[model samples]
Target: MSTHRILIAGFGGQGVQFAGRLLAHVGMYVGKEVSYLSSYGPEMRGGTSNCSVQISDKFIASPLVLEPTELVVMNGPSLEKFEKTVVPGGRIYIDSSIVAKPAVRSDIEPHPIPATALAEEMGLGRLANVIFCGYLIKKLDLCPLSALPAILKEVVSAKRPELLEGNLQALALGFSM
Candidate 1:
């Protein structure tokens, strides 16, 4: 009901930027105020990367999120970097297969999702961030379920209709977890 800020972090090429973009696009589709931003340096895929998306029923004033309602980390480094900054009672999603440890605090809820593994199982290894997005959506309850399939269909490959199905499967899997 209130503004929701989300931070998606990982090494570059992990689809963190795309994840944020997709969420922002979905927010736009639903007639919500949305902002998306990403960081890209020389290191790119091998180095740290971050993307933030803010969606709200009211106006969205900024794209940066130093404190987010939810945080999604694709690797250990991102998990560590954002763990301390997540707002209290916030949700954090980690790729459990890649990130072994969790935050020292217990107040912040952490969802350990084997997103990469699930994507691999679904034959779409490139969709790890999308899978994580599904989990983040499920955990945060930020958007309507009815809008998700439409979201994937709009943002993902139309050429590979199979991918849209796989992404939906991944989204459902995330919700189930």
Candidate 2:
């Protein structure tokens, strides 16, 4: 991929910012120029949250993703708000468990993954965002699955060492899907 302008949107507790940060870290880990910008509503847990991530081989001019090449929406409201912001032929990854309605845009390709459901089933409901991140990495061929352990180690080792194994399992689950 030359340049990927990714937009991830969802409710605050859905880990939208974490997902975007994970993607940006992956981009950085793979030696790409990366930028991440996050926005959230006033409320902490249930408010609107979204992030813009840019990964490019060249210099990135802006962090704002007005028209994203890849869109990930975790809830129905997010889908409704940002569905029209994806560029034509761009790919959208929807959390099918939360977003019951299908995307209305015909120009963009939509991938409906039951991320939240699968995470819940696996007893890792809060890691749905990581699951989606894994699927995104697999689907986009952004990086090798073998590289994730190291990445996850770096991400969770400092403060959340107990979460490493669960996160790994969640990533594997999503990748296999």
> Best by TM-score, which number?
2
**Native-to-model Cα distance after best TM-score fit, residue 34 in candidate 2, in Å:** 0.7
What is the lDDT of every predicted structure here?
0.81, 0.88
Tens digits of per-residue lDDT, candidate 2, 1-177, equal 678999999888788888898889888888999999997445335588999999899999989998999999998988988999899999999999989999998889989998998898989958999998898888877789899989888667577788889888888887888
Clashing pairs in 1: none
What are the TM-scores, per candidate, against the unseen true structure?
A: 0.87, 0.94
By summed lDDT, which 10 consecutive residues of candidate 2 come out lowest? 39-48
Candidate 1's residue-wise lDDT over 1-177, tens digit each?
788899998887788888898888877887889999886655355678898899899988877899988888898888877898889999888888788886676889878888888788877777888777777676667676777887778888678787777677767776666
Instruction: Give the residue spans of candidate 2 off by over 4 A.
Output: 40-46
- Per-residue lDDT, model 1, residue 149, is 86
